[model samples]
Target: MEEIEETPEEHLAKQHRKEKKDMQAKIQSMKNAIPKNDKKRRKQMTEEIAKIEADLNNKHEEELSQLKSSTDTKVEEVLNGVETMKMEGGKEAEAEAAEEEEEEEEEEEATQPRVTKAQKRRDKKATQEKERESRIAEAEVLNLQGVRHQEGLKLAQKLATKQLQIKEISSDGHCMYRAIEDQLAQRTKPEITMSMKELRSRTAEFMRGHADDFLPFLTNSNTGDMYTTDEFEKYCSDVEHTAAWGGQLELRALTQVLLLPMEVIQADSPPIKIGEEFDSEPVTLIYMRHAYGLGEHYNSVEQLKDPANAEDS
Candidate 1:
């Protein structure tokens, strides 16, 4: 009740998202490395991509389906968890009334721990928390499994319509950092691209020095408390030294440290435009929801075809 922890269903989702991203990234890398003239290898790469797409999508779908079913059979599950705590407390009161005279129930209430209102309230909160967790799991399963394969096509369609194509980044946990690296290479030209490690370190350092800006927005998932100074340090250390996933928090830090705007293009939503104060061209990255095995993924954006070298390919 004090803190929300990852349930088994969530753990399964986390595993599958990582697997999906790794497989897709691996295939994309292989495809990118093949020479243009190697039509045969290109065909092979295409085939492999198709094969893994089907396999990973099916695997993730089946696993989530099974997990969802296991949770849904109970009325307490996310989708049907509409029952109120008051109703649950009423049921307990009804049961107590059936077993004892009103005066006896009152006596028990006065002396017995099990029939006390405090105990009942605690139980209600516990059930409420479980239902909340189930709701979170349901969303994750839907995002990572039910619509996994279609995400890429939808993204591609959006990109093609917009005359943009993916500049694939690896599926590793450092995806956000790598995506920024790729974007920087395009914007700065002959300037050397910064390493993902360096970018992460810089972002972490920025976050630490400007704690006031970010800490208010972050809370301890386990304790449901605002991060203390020590916990924020630990988070910063992990950002710098660990393969912790980066989100808008790190993105905010990166925008400040690098002094540039960044655009997050998603398949289904309008681009999540960040850093409006700067006049620089925004480095663009695509955000995936249901597509990548990683469950969520980011890739650099580029012109679908280079106009200057249109006929070269």
Candidate 2:
């Protein structure tokens, strides 16, 4: 069968419909997978599915609106091209082709059933990019300032020369581990990358086995005494099983666990290099004291595509 060539607008619109259908079908499948006797689970899933559907509808409407705008723009462009064709000795083929495409677009708009696999990948990437931008904008709205803000600016200036930007990690007491995880995911291959739980576990295990290295520094604030064996055990348990805020000791342990050097960049201080004995390239993380109103937070650094145009600079 001969493949039909669609105008850009028609092509994009068709892709939009397929994405919507795929999402709806996925939700339906999820709904079906929930057992009928599981009333509580069914209710939760139904609510979540409804919310997803609402969001999807809004997104689809916005895209369709954009397509409508693009359609108007394309019509204007085609008219301009047709006028040019008339001026250039009346090129009948070019004008007729444009006319047919416009007619075909109208006829086929409601019948678009499928989109290519490559288009799905492109759509997914576009969605992720938009989500990233949305996160950045949200952080901007709740701006940080004063000491932390100044430090962030200084760090930004430093990173500008290196074509890097701070990718903010969530401030849920696990920022340090999360920042390291993010850096590892980007810097290392999949097999070498560690998840939050794995990183936490390794940090705890390393600290537990090498108590003398870390225990000396962990004095009780109330008693002014070194941690007892049980106290230390509890601390390590929290480090591994709970969202205990990761600190210098965890960073030190992670360097050994992953067998990679860790570089910590900070404002008002020099870069702190851990695991210097290792020969591998360091996974870098930035320490933010007050950015995003999250005190003592950690963020990862990523290189910008347009390195020449650093926005924070």
Candidate 3:
């Protein structure tokens, strides 16, 4: 028995199907490469893939329709030369085909996913809010852990009161500056709030002017050598303008800027003091702890009223 040869139309359809499948697979691979937590990138890739898929579908449909129309025209011409009855039958077949095509187009339109720009914006906002909430919850958990550890400290210089409130600061690389700003605002008259930018500028200037004091401690952790002059200049510039993560070095500069000792209280440890002692009455207390693997964070600590004082009130 001889195998039947494939028609030109069948071959064309098979080629289009393979092209469509390959394109779909490529799109899927691109989607898979995007990180799940990166909603913005995921949304962008999704939109791009949707456009590509739409274009492919439209081009495939147009090509197939043109091929079918050419075939129909050839059939009509053959029928006209053969018989009027066959020609009339061909017209009925064409009408049925048109109806079926219309139904298929309507089904495609109904099944196509529809998402408006407004809807997309809302979804993006919701995703951002969810991520923000998750971060806040994680920070709160870390804060509680730090508080528990602080409570268990065996130091004689413990917090005046057993009860303390912790105020979390934003950990956007400027946590140290923001934390210092919060402590200053609470400890000063008229409640001064220093912007992170201003704090950065002041800290940079102080470090640059008093390089002798800070340069010794500014050695590269990897190299274990003192920072070169160029490196120190770059460090000063980063402290001044960039959102560089602040550490003990910047904290020392901050002490000089504020002209007061910046005492850091940690869980189960003596207060790590910075800068020269001042005769000031109020001392800024910062709760220091590692937060969610994001380096060390400083949260302002507000001492609760003494039980005796509360009873008198």
Task: For residues 62-98, write the lDDT of model 3, one tens digit per residue.
Answer: 9889989999999999878768755767977878888
What TM-score should be assigned to candidate 3? 0.47
Clash counts for all predictions = 5, 0, 0
lDDT of every model, 2 decimals: 0.76, 0.78, 0.68
Q: How accurate is candidate 2 locally (lDDT)?
A: 0.78
**Compared with the true structure, what per-residue lDDT tens digits does model 1 show for residues 1-313?**
3445668787897779768767867675564444333356668778978988999999999999988888777646544444554466687776776677878878978996555798678877997678668767876777664566466767777777667788887776678889888888787552346889999899999999999999999876556789899888888988898767688899989888887888888767887878889778887888876444324677888888754343332
TM-score of each: 0.51, 0.53, 0.47
Error of 3 at 196 (Å): 1.5
Q: Distance (Å) between predicted and true CA of 160, model 1? A: 2.3
C-alpha lDDT (0 to 100) for residue 231 of candidate 3: 78
TM-score of 2: 0.53
- What candidate 1 gets wrong by more than 4 Å, as runs, is 1-146, 188-192, 306-313
Cα lDDT over the full model 3: 0.68
Taking the tens digit of each residue's C-alpha lDDT, what string does model 2 give over 200-292?
889999999999999998866557799899878888998888766677888998888988899988887899999999988788899876554
